[model samples]
Target: MTEPTGLGMSKVARILMVEDDEDDYILTSDSLEQLDSYQFDIHWVTNPKVAVEKLSQEEFDICLLDFQLGAQSGLDVLRQAIKLGCMTPIIMLTGQDDDNLDKLAQDAGAVDYINKEDISTGRFARAIRYALARNEVASERLERLKAETQNRSKDRFLAHLSHELRTPLTSILGYTELLLQGEKAKESRSELNIILSNGKHLLSLLNDVLDLSKIAADKLELNPSEINLDSFIADVFYLLQINAQDKGLSLVITAPQALPERIRADSTRLRQILINLSYNAIKFTDHGQVAIKLWTEWVEQKELLFFEVADTGIGIPAERLASIFKPFEQVEDIVTRKEGGAGLGLAICTELARRMGGELSVESELGKGSRFRFAIEPGDISDVPRSELHFVKADTNQDNEHYDPLQGRVLVVDDAPDIRQLVQKICDGFGLQVVTAENGLQAVQMCNESLSLDTPFTLVLMDIHMPVLGGRQAIAQIREAGFTAPVIALTAAALKGVKRSLVDIGFSDVLHKPINKKALYQCMSMHLAAQESGEQIDEVEPHILLVEDDVDAAEVSKMLLESLGAKVTLAFTGAECLAVLQSSLPVCKILLDLHLPDTDGLSLAAQIRTISPELEIVVVSGAQIEASQLSALNISRSLLKPLNLSTLQSLID
Candidate 1:
């Protein structure tokens, strides 16, 4: 060019060459001279110190620095240029191939590196272009990371805020429920129901917001467990059936008779997905039906199980389907507005499916129907031993049911006076004798006294977090004191894996607050049924071989069993039980405590099976073993301690 052009108007690249060797400089100059893209204006700096100063003093499109510069290395100059706040992209030229030096050069802020042995006109030009592009990308990535960090901080703050908000909301809901139960006036009950309904709706909104935040921050985790696929889907359908009925729609579940009996999946998330889709279908549909079908498909050599919720509702127009899964992007129409959602359910579901190695998809026709489906590979599916499955009647509205008199005493422990009173009132209304404690310390003390007074607690509802002592420590003390009435954990913390953790830490079950009266009664009624049945013994008394290591425990158990009119032969260890079994004595039942001085309960049970396969084996222990696990071990029945006298009698009979 005859005249120098401004950078904004120029096709030439202003380049800086930093090298001490004259021959290397000449080679680089020759390479630049042959570039096809643009003309190069070279500014040569032989000294490393001058190179950094030149970079800081003048603007350049790109810089090429040799790895070896006399007594100094190009990495030092690259660092100096970066420290001087030079924004130009830098490429390092090395005489020999060294991956370590290349990494060092990049770490010192070099965008790209090339070996002098492989240098050519085209190669040199391509390196410059790549270096410039890489630098731009790095800058963009830094900005994106900063934005994400800020967004994550905001999400965490919101989640903490929402949890704090729920603490009071739980109390409000609890009191509202208590009032609704007590209010006899029709108008008062109606008003209370409205309050309870709105309270629950608000709680649902908060949960959805928190879930969205967790998913955005990538803090949501999968908790896979063995689930009976047929039962699980059936349960979900049953739950939503009422909703569909209220909306004048039919809810149905279609599945093959045989499914993967036990598929390992995050049952909670799966339930959440089904509930969201089914509820939405019912909500949007004025009439017609909602059907759920589960089947497996093999795709790309992978076995994927599919769950589909198809609704004959007001379907989305074909054009709007693309944006349905986008957060807060519901169809901008009067009907969608009337549906009343923040438009986050589908987005959250989509993210959850993707995180769990699955995909959520939809198919729709305007004014026809919509089908939302998600599928996951059975990589986590667990093989559950095949057995006859027992189905418990759905316990959705047990409090409203006409239950047989709750003929048992239950201990309710919580720090909240209102909560304690509420539980007491509910239990008393069901004809259950209720004793209340304000803290774990009192609960443990009461349990000890009850066992001593021959009025052992039928069930204990223990709060997890309380003053003086926590439920965990209290349960430990109670167990140490030989008290094992089933202790269910009552808490306001509905955290993931909390149920399993509570069970692991000596809880028979978990009830989240503000407690559902129906759920609480359902849980309590199951244990109480055993107590009520134990009162009337129809079968002949069982001759029992009771194996217990603890002296006090053995004596107490013997007394309890004898009270049921059963003959007891006490065995203090596994060896003692074997010795007794080897004899000609008729041992009709073996009540085995899992923890023994000589061997574990499982091994002892297995050994006993070999000796007498038909003998009834009742595993009584403080250990946490799931029902499925107990079944697999061939144990006929397992009971959690401190023992319920009535349950013991029924099991023995």
Candidate 2:
């Protein structure tokens, strides 16, 4: 048999020939040496025992075994090699009439079985080359799979650890806020502030870790809404003002005076993307200004809103700009080690921009600074009545003192005793009449009794999942009974389904579990205004109709939504969707899965629009939906699975 060239040029591939006959062994070796490109060094063994011994001592690239080797068959040697994890490819040579031996050789781990009478130089060489190439490809695939599994395990562990850390961190922040507000000792006050600040910083790090995990898993979601460009930029400036001030840098924002007030985008994600870019800009710029410029351009009938964050800092080298966006990659190795970051900010921003149907690019010079620009298509901006913009701004104190609304009744319901006590203490500290319930049933009973006494509950803090009668069920019953109090679902379950179910079950609002003190106060203050107005609050929970064809996944997701208190109607196909729309349940939002066996998601969304053009539709797909398709469908939001609970909550909120 002829050996192939290029196969053994580097470290010559060793081959073991196991044959009992001396004549056959010499002939095989002569044939291999005579080939034009044959470079392998052949080791001839007269017995199977000697061949096995050589295999144990040497690493051969390929093995050629004769079917007949005295009493010891080639099959025996092949089995022994396989048992020892010998991955070398083996080719078995057999007599033309020895069909049984050829079959047995293959069953024992020989890669290929060839007949000696039929073997030619061309066929023999081609077979060897094919075997080696196949082995290499298999090895590569195995290595890749191993690496992927390791990464996934690490991600899962981090996610679980972060979740555990959040629980106590929430309590620490809660107690610290109380101490900071109450009449604590002066010395203790300063220490509490330090504690609060450190806690907040740690919380931010934890959030970053969670966000990174979500991005890696492709579970990060965007909740796009129409945002006023001027107002949005103003808010961003307000948020970054402190950072810029600390660095003694000038930060400027410039936009057209009459620029479109509304652009369709995910506000939180947009804020995150901008914050990362702006902070980097400010961090690097020690002496110069960091300017953010916004403009709108119409390119080929698409309205692209462009933003540029230009900083006059120590800029990146021209050659390193491309590599800067890679995860854990920075301009220089020392820059990352000194600057203290996972070097993932830019990478995350780039990915977020891509998900928002835009591209993020940068231009910089070594001595000057860098300019990072990204653009997203402008969303539909309908005229909002002037009256809706009239919101009362809370008074700010020079001392950053907490504002406590006096003598209000507050109800707190939660499964965790620590969380219940925490809420009660905060409310009592505010001088409010606080009532506590361990579960939803007690909460409902208290609400009913308060109504009878003509001192109806001012507000109800209901936990989503309780021992008897969950938050959603209790809220629905209370609302059905004409109780006008604002019921907020306080839940620790951050899953999308849980939040959606809470909203669906007719709660006034949802505050994610492990509640933030500031967020709780804000909710209370807003609801109190509604209570004073004496307006009969309508139980108008947003309706989200999920259209998906995968039965098992759909059922599980539906249950999750129900847990979140969302009234969900599932349609397995486009035909089902059309039928549902015909029946007349007004849907506030629709979650459309793109790939369906019966009909496509995009087509279903279009059909829904034909019925109710104003219906909010969120496209759900396993694959990334292109910008072109989103524009064509007029889809405001797109969620990729496994879906993020926070993104879904933001959309409904």
Candidate 3:
């Protein structure tokens, strides 16, 4: 701990006096002693160098220095002490009353200039008190500035680290997706699916941790929009349906018909809060169900919608409930440890809700499960514009998707070989001949060369950070030279204001790293003339063998698949699955469940694979599925319980 240096308190002042004359020192000490406001402890140092050392190293309330130190300069001592980072209050004592000398003394780092001839208790004490007080204020400001500098450094470090992490992850996820989207996707997709799933999971974990860091620093930013309540609730339920199914639990949502259709809020953050809370509920609960209920409460003339996520899981004990919302806090139990989390879900959820003009509260019985609730003001229908539709469904039907012919080639620029090649592959798939550049410097040169030859590149996918030249500077050079092709920034940095800043700095658009293939395609298509959208083809009805233990859930899922035009054959038990596979039914895919009353789900999968080695098997269960388990059973991929129809349709079709 740092020692207190009499920071304006009614206490004894520790003073250091550097004066060669014994008579002057005695006179100055007597003046300070006559002050009724303070007691003084004076230490005398005659040597200028010693005075400098003492001021620099010792903790004192104030220092009194003589202008002339017999053959040494008092000004030299003050300069040296200040240079050495002294925080003590320093007052220069002078025999001469020259205005120039007083100004010089004050400018040389002294808090005040006091004349020896005008030595009086009141005047000396006034100067001493003011110096001490100003010094304390300066010290506090310095500390605060140092703290701010450290925080900025920390944010920069996180950004750099995020970039480094996302670089390799981009390669991993990029190649995995490419392979999955390839002609031989049927052959290697199962193994690649593991890599893709885990890679995305790791990304989510990274984002969650980064969110905590930003929130702790009070820098977490929210982008609010007029969101359709219908879509928001559907998405939350769709995302977490798997978690509920992993343990044979029902994930349900109940909202009144009178519920508002739209709300002005940060939909992404709101979704994150619900997902985290509901996932936490599923993690702690061993059986039963997780339900999301919505109602309205009007208070103070404002319409507030109350959302409750209740689960029949092992609930929190009363004492520990308070700390459960704290970062890195978790209930100490075998289930919690085994379920595995960084104990950040609930903490982040509660904070997110509070930050969004709402408060999250929870109630639980130790063994009966928990109910998490929060409320937010719902906006009226006028919040959403007519042009803005609430639900815009994507054409997941690959058969109906088509691309037009490309009119020009693209330039793929990146320092990473993996990314450049990955993008090249994607561009090639888009039926556009692609050129490559290692950095922005190379990109600028190639772009100019192409333009000079009357064959300028159509679009430039530029990496932000490169060795020879960074994307921002290079793009500026390109734009200055009159190259007007759309140059999209491919970066790993997702720092706040990055996109807008990039746009301001000449980038046409921004495509973040750990490259989402779909997002990249969309971004590219917006600028480049897309050659061919997937042409409409005759629909191929997938013959699926869905083996689920819950008959009701299975029936609902089967109907959804059939509605998507799939010929679904449902099996309630593992034995029933084998019997179907043994029959001459053209079963292209099998959605297997790990939990079944008759036999082990894994054993059943192994049996089916042995009977028909070419048949694709997908696991649908509530428990966490491991890569090793999938590899062992020759399982293509595992879908979490309560499958979203679009995701299921895309997988089967």
Candidate 4:
């Protein structure tokens, strides 16, 4: 509703003077005429009503109004001009120099206030130019703020959508895992695999969408940690190798002979980026090869870790490359439709790379191939051996020893019957007894009863979310009832910080769902051997403490110790073992796993020696430490994993 611009007038000063006094109007005209820089064309209105009408009809560079009119004041004319919706700048001309009147005149939309005696052409021109520039700046700022607010609203909606999608996806993946493991009918294996695969694919897509929303809103953050890049990439590649084999494509990994053992990066997100690009390459390529190469290069005085994933099947058209990195955009073709994605992978990768202080780019040609390359700033190197070099493939049948020496019951609590049955079946396969509970409340009552009967459960597997008395609350109540058994949290919520939160909520450990049978067995074995039995015995059996962080290694050692007629108590980390010893647990010897997650074995042994001077400490590790080193730590014996049972028995005797 404001005035458009200057009216159809020549290059001259156009002024509207709203004053009823004849002398004041003549004085203003004569004052303007004294300025020879520009010609003056003045329009005089005698009343406030006529001033408003002229403001609506004609455009003027500025308006000058006398403070006192015949029956109305200059403030009245100022308000009328503003009400008529003309943006023409106004300067109030007053006979008396009063501060209050000047304030009132500006507040009513006058650009500036001037006394009639002080008015000059130069002062009027400056006020008009300043007002126009200030209004334009304010308008631009308001528009920008509005756009930012709308974008934030959209990001919040996307985050909410992610949470809603994950809740159901959890159930889908968990049940599929149960069926895949427990269903003995070979005919159903392929079908179960398909269900599991598609569910995981859906999860990946949902995560990509949420990631894009985060990057767009500048909310994505990095959590950097030391990572063994060689071992990590091998593991990521091994996962997708089967898909390549199925598609009749060769999968290749090329790396330098001696890459740095460790680099600083957000391992999870780094792995995610690689996996997404690798999956996309394999999905689009048919009867071709996928190559992943890793190397390091110096860029701008900083070492950049470079990764490239290339394929040999189909390549993008030249015109489509730019748009492919845009959200929800893809090459329109039958192949794209058949692949079936929302086209968020490359867009997310580009943003993630940028956030990591790097860039992602591509090179491709139609019907030839495409290569995606990315690099990021590499941080300090570690002296520890590369994980691939130190890694030893575990013996799957290491627990084939038919000792079954330890006798205790486990409590399996889950609302899903399929999960409970599947876990029970696995426990049964390993020759352990299990009791089932449909919810956390039922599990708590069972635990309390078992303790009162002097037959405490060895382990509790509690699901995190359920209908009645959720897992966290149930654990708190159990702890209050003085039950001290290790409770593992079995959760479908695998988001970041979930594991830390579960531990803080008093869970001994966490296991993400769509369970791996081997991992489940390792978790149960580790916790089940966590403490010695409270039962009294006639003859004192050697109560040995086994402290090891790796569950498979701990399980193997537990079987060996039990076979040697020693009751074993397992602790997964240095802190847990120290906590156990502080509780005055009866111990004759300690079989300590030196590679503890929280502390090194030698350091832990020294600490243990200081606290328990009479206790015998033995170092157990997958790593090779020298005999002299063990002596320096004041340790008598050291045992290597893939343990020698005969040697262990002789030492125990």
Ranking by lDDT, best first? 3, 1, 4, 2
Q: Each model's number of backbone clashes?
A: 3, 14, 19, 0
Q: Where does candidate 1 stray beyond 4 Å?
A: 1-149, 172-200, 300-302, 331-336, 377-392, 399-653
Candidate 3 lDDT over 559-588, as tens digits, reads 998888888877889877775555434578
What's model 3's TM-score?
0.69
* All candidates: TM-score: 0.44, 0.57, 0.69, 0.51
TM-score, candidate 4, is 0.51
Model 3 / residue 450 / CA error / Å: 1.3
- Model 3's alpha-carbon lDDT is 0.78
lDDT of 2 by residue, 1-653 (tens): 22245555433456788877777777667666654443667887877777777777666767888887787777888899788777778898877666676677778889888776545566666776677567667767667778767876976576457546665775887777766656655568768867876787677666666666678766676778877655677667866777899999999887653466557789877887787889889888888799988776776776677888999988887778889898778654624344666677788888888888788999998779889999776675434321122122232111265666655788898766777888898677567788899887888788888887856678888766567887766776677577777888775444334444455446677787456766777877777777888764444444578888766568777777777678788888887766555532447788888898787888877887898787778888878889898888788879888765675667667
TM-score of predicted structure 1: 0.44
What tens digits encode model 1's per-residue C-alpha lDDT throughout 1-653? 11235454325667899988888889888887775455778888898889989988887878998998888878888888899899888999998888898888888888788999767756767887676556557667667778867885886577456646665666778777666545354567757766776787788777778788767655566878777765776677666777888888988777653457678778878777778888888888887899888777777876777889999888988878878888887643524678678888888888878766689999987778899999875564435443333333354312345656676788999887877887887788778889999899999889999997766788899877778998877876787687756778887655455565455445667887767777788888776665556642122233588999876689898999888878887888998888667643457889899999899999988889898888888898787788886787677888889987888868765
Q: Candidate 4 residues 116-171, lDDT tens each? A: 76756567556644654454455556566678668758755764565456556656
Task: Estimate every model's Cα lDDT from 0 to 1.
Answer: 0.76, 0.73, 0.78, 0.75
Candidate number of the best TM-score? 3
Which residue window of length 10 is worst by lDDT in model 3?
531-540
Model 4: lowest-lDDT 10 consecutive positions: 390-399
- Candidate 2 regions with alpha-carbon error over 4 angstroms: 1-16, 20-23, 26-50, 53-62, 86-89, 99-113, 121-141, 174-198, 207-213, 226-234, 331-338, 382-653
